[model samples]
Target: MLSGFFRLEYQNRTVLGEWKKVHWLKWKVSIGLSTIN
Candidate 1:
């Protein structure tokens, strides 16, 4: 049971990390576009 809980936690972290990465990429793109304009 403890192992399962840990696994779920790990999965959540992985998903959160991916989400943050996507947002960060989008943020960088917006900044680049603003500078160009």
Candidate 2:
């Protein structure tokens, strides 16, 4: 039971990490475009 809980937590963290990475990339791209224009 404890192992399953830990596995779930790990999965959540990875999903969150990927989400943050995608958002960060999009944010940077928008900033770059604004600066260019």
Candidate 3:
């Protein structure tokens, strides 16, 4: 039972990490475009 809980927590962390990375990349791209214009 403890192992299952740990696995769920790890999965959530990875999912959140990926979500943040995607948002960060999008923000960088938007900034670059604004600067270019």
What's the lDDT for all of these models?
A: 1.00, 1.00, 1.00
lDDT of 1 by residue, 1-37 (tens): 9999999999999999999999999999999999999
Give candidate 2 misplaced runs (Cα > 4 Å): none
**lDDT per residue, candidate 2, 1-37, as tens digits?**
9999999999999999999999999999999999999
lDDT of 3 by residue, 1-37 (tens): 9999999999999999999999999999999999999
**Model 3 residue pairs with clashes:** none
- Alpha carbon deviation, residue 5, candidate 3 (Å): 0.5
Candidate 3's C-alpha runs over 4 A off are none
Ordered list by TM-score, greatest first: 2, 1, 3
- For model 2, give the 10-residue run with minimal summed lDDT: 1-10
What is candidate 2's CA lDDT for residue 13? 100
lDDT of 2 at 19: 100
Candidate scoring better on TM-score of 1 and 2: 2
